[model samples]
Structure formats: structure tokens, C-alpha cells
Target: MGFGAILDININHISTRLAYWLARNFDEKFDKLNVGKHQIKITSDTVYEVFGIPKGPKKVEIIADKRKVKKQEKI
Candidate 1:
């Protein structure tokens, strides 16, 4: 495999899974709820922080049904 390909695969297998599993089992700031389009979503920027890859500044989205309802009700 090429250098870039190897790097991508490693990131996918290790970093991605590690971040997800940690978020699933340990992280609690991000809350999960059922929404219309997406069934599960959380409100946390910890994923990128955990990934720790210096990409550009990007906004993270956290979606949840209860949050949506709260927003709609102006609560």
C-alpha cells in the first residue's frame, strides 16, 4: 500500500474506533436522543479534541430530539 493509504487505514482502524468507543462508554457530556432524520446524536466537541488531528477549525454538531424540542419551545 502507498504511504497515504496506509496512514488513512491506520487512522480509520485505530483513531476512529478509539474515539467512538470512548465516546460511547466513557464520555458523558454529549447526550444521545432520537431525532427525525438521525436516530442517535450527541452534543459534544470532544470527538475532534480526542482525535487530536490538526485539521482546520471546524464546527461540531450535536443533534438530539429533546434539545430540538427545547429549542422550538424557546426554553
Candidate 2:
């Protein structure tokens, strides 16, 4: 396999309990979760690997309007 990386997520169903636990133990400064015995790395890449991508139309925020409301000033 020439793939640069391989992900192995055994998530069969969602668990709110685990989510709450992780949230409580998560350290914002280090960006990791202290799972009582050890720490689990929680980076953006890891999150994407576990949850994959959203399956639906793109969600555009109101603030993300494409209208050119303000003209840019020339340097």
C-alpha cells in the first residue's frame, strides 16, 4: 500500500459518556486528554481521522457572506 498514512478507528456508535469524560480531562494548554492512567493526543488530524468529513451541503455562515461589502484599500 503506497498510502502515506492509515487510520484505524473502531467506533461503532456514538458515546456521550466518553465524550464528557474526555472533555473533562482535556488539557487546553497541551491539547491532550489525561485518561486517568495516561494521556491521549487529540490533534486536528486525529479528530478528522475518527469522525471523517461531513456528508451534506456546505454550511456557509452568515458572517461568511461572499458580498464585497468593504472595498480594499490600495497599499
Candidate 3:
């Protein structure tokens, strides 16, 4: 919960039935649920509303490896 936000909410147990259905129903290419004839829209707003996770930009942390990187050689 609140993945990209500073104030994160505690995680609770997920619904096994619903999760299973979603896993099987979700279409990656369409970004929606293609269950039979129904096409359920899955947007950023919907995601935030459903999961409480931030639908905004995320902060990325990169750790540089020192040992593997060599210093520039003089020309």
C-alpha cells in the first residue's frame, strides 16, 4: 500500500479467490480484464483506488559498484 508515497500503509491479507481470478483474467497487452465478453478497464486511477498504491512517479535508488569499475586511463 502507498508504494510510491512517503506514508505507507500496512499490508493486509489478500483475497485468494479474487487474486486468482485477476491473475487468470488480466490481459497485459490491453491493460484490462478480458473475461469472456466483458472488458474491465484497468487504469492508474483504478489501481490507486483499489490497492491504495500511489499512481505517480517512483523514486529509484542506484548503487554504483566500485570494485568492478576501473578508473579512466590517461590518453
Candidate 4:
């Protein structure tokens, strides 16, 4: 794929997942939940009305990477 195509895919993936997470957890921001150079984060709230989670002991955390991927040049 082209550079623009890769970027578009990345943006779409993040936006889609973020929207779903927000809708389910009702949290505007996400919290980091793992050890790695990549700063992956997620919602801290457990109660998700959309998902029908009345009360949860733990919140959902989805790992994400927003770094731009280098496109391969044609030889």
C-alpha cells in the first residue's frame, strides 16, 4: 500500500477503537496498562452502559500504536 493508504488505515483503526471504547466505558481519555516503549492506554471506568456492564472490578485496556509506518519504495 501507499504511504497515504497506511496512514489512513492507522487513523481509521484508532478512531474506530477509540469511539467504541468511549461509548462502552463513558471515558473520554484512556489510561496506560502495560510495559512497553509504545504508550498504549485505555479506559479506567468499569461501568459501561452500552456494553451492559453494571459494575466491573477491572476496566478494559486496548493497546494501540500511532507511529507512522514507513512505506517501501519500489526498486
Q: Could you tell me the TM-score of candidate 1?
A: 0.19
Q: Which window of ten consecutive residues has the lowest lDDT sum in model 2?
A: 1-10
Per-prediction TM-score: 0.19, 0.43, 0.48, 0.19
RMSD to the true structure for each prediction, in A, is 14.5, 15.0, 13.5, 14.9
1 or 2, greater by lDDT = 2
Clashes of each: 0, 0, 0, 1
Clashes in predicted model 2 = 0
- Which ranges of candidate 3 are over 4 A from the true structure? 1-11, 49-53, 59-75
Between prediction 2 and prediction 4, the one with superior lDDT is 2
**Could you give candidate 4's per-residue lDDT for residues 1-75 as a string of tens digits?**
113333334343334555455465533455553334454444423223223344556665754553543333332
For 1-75, candidate 2 gives per-residue lDDT tens digits of: 222233355544446666567678999999998977998887756655555643355665564565634433432
Ranking by TM-score: 3, 2, 1, 4
Number of the top TM-score candidate: 3
Q: 3 or 4, which is superior by lDDT?
A: 3
Instruction: Please report, in order, the local distance difference test score of every candidate based on alpha carbons.
Output: 0.43, 0.61, 0.69, 0.42
Residue-level lDDT tens digits of model 3 in 1-75: 334552364644345666678899999888999779999889988778766766678864564787654444432
lDDT value for model 2: 0.61
